[model samples]
Target: MRFRRLRAIALKELLQIWRDPRSLMIALLMPFTQMFLLGYGVTLDLKHIPVCTFDREASQNSQSLLKHFEASSYFAIARNVRTYPELISAIDRSDCKIAIVVPPDFSERLNDTGTSSVQAILDATDDNTANIAYGYAVAIVSGYSNDVALDALGRQGGELQQIQPVAVQSRVWFNEDLDSRNFIIPGLVAVIMALVGAQLTSLTISREWERGTMELLVSTPVTPSEVMVGKLAPYLALGWIDASFCLIIATLWFGVPFRGTLFTLFATTTLFLTVVLGIGYLLSVLIRSQIGASQVALLLTMLPTTLLSGYVFPIDQMPTIIQDITYLVYSRYYVTIIKAIFLKGAGIAALAVPILFLLVYAAAVMTLAARAFRKRLD
Candidate 1:
């Protein structure tokens, strides 16, 4: 009998949600759109860095070295300069990110002393890109040097077996291709859900107050607990649908791997939705103004979820106080769970701490929201 009442309230809420086209659009389409924008728009991979060369040698060996740089997909030779000043000008003008300076005695010294040196100058304004480009340049030069050394030893009647070195083989686990999208798309699940879940419920009760319908509902036979459950039900279903869309897009469109079972994914998403929805409900009950509730919800959910939740940045690298404050951000646990499931194939046993934290967070926020609702009624 009591279940029938809850069902009626839930149905009414669903009807109301349907009546508002904007709300319906938000619930049905916003998450997928947001994920698409963020997933494809942002990237960290560096490629095709422009390079300038100052080749004083004009020799066969110097030209050979330049050919190696030109052959690599990582670098594009933008200009060949005659002077050091011209090389500096190319980098300063943003025409190139890397500059290679080959000395005049390059081939002569290499043939005579079995050694040669070249200088690589890099633009350090963007440190991460600079570092990666430097590494690529170093690797290319090192490989060329090794080949030259091997050829020189062969001409000296040395055997290939006496080249003298260890060959190392490396195997990357989990994400072998090392695609940044693999790491990024999974964390986006938590971020998108945090925004969608909170934004949906943030306006619910507050909109009732704005439209003068709350007093009517309060005067009816429907209990505050029933109203709360009804308000949460439709949005919870929407949240699950949004989460499923995110998972599908992450896997099919973005090519992110999902190594965990659907059961674990659904369970973690439910716990996360509960916490975010409770926060929105509590805000709605306390603020009673739809505009204020929406603003507060945006502030609470979106910024922290993207920034502090380790979705884009590592929380461990943050200062001690900031790291401590991140414990309060519920999306942190969800991001951890989502990434682990998508990347590591972590089970419930491996993710017990985050799961426990989400449980506690859901319980605490929902209890607070219930208390706030009752107080508002009084």
Candidate 2:
């Protein structure tokens, strides 16, 4: 008999969700759309770059270097300046991201001592862009030096002692190829689960309250736990379907690797959904109106989950207090687990901490939601 009522309620919720095309569209498209926008938008690739040159020397070597900068695909010489003041003024006016100063003794020093230094001033307004520009400038200068010294090296190569420099090799561990899709799809899965589980469940339950169904529900023989589970079961299924779609799309279309056990991933994701759905249920009980519950759920879940969960922004770089706060957010552990399982092939032992956190989050949120429901019904 209880199974019949549970099925009826779940069926009604699914029907309502099906009728709402907006919610259906969001469930389908939001994750992929975010992946496309944020992945392409946050790239490290450099294209046409604005640069200014202050060549006071105007010598053959300086002219040769300037020609190389002009010819390179990475840089466009936006302005030529004879004085430091003009270069500073151009940078201040946002004419160029980088300024190169060639000293008066550039060619003379190179001819006499075989070594010369150039000054590159980078605008620090956008640190990442500035860092890339700085590397490009350094590469251009190093190429110039290499080209000029090739002839000298060729002449003295026979029986000459060579200078060896210390070299550092860097390797990325989890993402060997640095495929942004691997990181992004997992993060999007976390964000999408948060939105669906929290926003939808909260709004649906709040709608029930506004429609005076909660009074009828509490007056029935159904237990609070059963009612709460019944209310969340449909959304939980929806969240699972959304997650499956994301995992398949990312793996098949984008070629994102899934290295860990699929069962482990699903288990962790289920815990995450429970925490998010519980929060939604708690929000619904606290706020009597659908709009208020929806707003509160969105505010509590969406922004922080996306921003502070190390989805796009690395948590290591965030403020310490904010990092401390992320511990309480279910999505934080979800992002960690998904990224680890997908990218790092991390097993249960490797993911124990995040798994524990997710379980604890689910338990806490579920307890709170049950209490909220009891209070509201009484």
Best by lDDT: 1
Where in model 2 is the C-alpha error above 4 Å? 44-48, 54-93, 143-151, 159-162, 176-185, 248-258, 375-378
Error of 1 at 36 (Å): 2.2
Q: In the order shown, what is each candidate's alpha-carbon RMSD?
A: 2.1, 3.3
Local distance difference test, per candidate? 0.89, 0.82
- Give the C-alpha miss distance for residue 363 in model 2, angstroms: 1.6
Deviation (Å) of 12 in candidate 1: 1.7
What is residue 38's positional error in candidate 2, in angstroms? 2.9
Question: How many backbone clashes does every candidate have?
Answer: 0, 0
lDDT of 1 by residue, 196-219 (tens): 888879989999989988877777
In model 1, what is the error at residue 273, expressed in angstroms? 0.9
Instruction: List, residue by residue over 29-56, the lDDT tens digit for candidate 2.
Output: 7767755666556544566789999998
